[model samples]
Target: MDGKKALYYAAIAIAVLIGVGIVISVISALVTLVSTVISAAISLAVLAGIVYVAYKAGSWLLGSDDSPSMDSIGSGSSTSVDAGTSRQDRLRQQYVEGQISEAEFERRIGEELETEEIDDIDRELERER
Candidate 1:
């Protein structure tokens, strides 16, 4: 998304620059106003076309603009594993290193994995059934 925004802003900047150049040249008598304006419009139009084409190509090749796939993968989601360490191992290390107590580690691990905590009332209902 950031990349797309940057690319889009860059395209707009380039088009505006070209248009301004045309206007400047016309005012300086380097070219007739009508011809210069026409040329600027054409140049801007061409740049607009290029931007659209680039966006389409990027989206088609990368997936949705907001979720463009990384070039290395070419397709699909990329996983970052803290650069490839196991979650279980990391948790264990935290415990071993005294960074977290056993209860805290267990609580955090459960939360991270979205494990549900059954309330006492829910447990009683299950037992009754």
Candidate 2:
């Protein structure tokens, strides 16, 4: 009877140890997963920052002047020209400077007129809405 009791006690101890070991393993796996997720998020944020900086640097270095900056918005500046007028002015300038032929200027003007008509239609739709 004493030997049987001792054997039963040993079996309970082994089961308890196995349960503790499984709990520890699960905790470690959860910790490792959380750490990996944090690392990946940090890596992605750094990559995005680098890409944005590179894009700004490239734009600055290449002298891209067509896009309006925040400073130019609502400043009531006389230099600000609408897209249709700007295109027409640029085409006329090129033609006067002999950079483009009369045929090319006329073709571009026709395209600009078509675009302006579409824009007018869009504005009318918005007004109706």
2-97 per-residue lDDT for model 1 (tens digits): 999999999999999999999888787855767889999999999999999999889877777654345535421123322223576788899999
State TM-scores per candidate.
Answer: 0.28, 0.56
Best by TM-score: 2
Model 2, residue 16: displacement in angstroms? 1.1
lDDT of 1 at 76: 18
Candidate 2: RMSD over Cα atoms?
Answer: 8.1
lDDT of 2: 0.86
| Model 1, CA-based lDDT | 0.72
Q: In candidate 2, how many clashes are counted?
A: 0
Clashes of 1: 0
Which stretches in model 1 have alpha-carbon errors above 4 Å? Answer: 1-31, 65-129
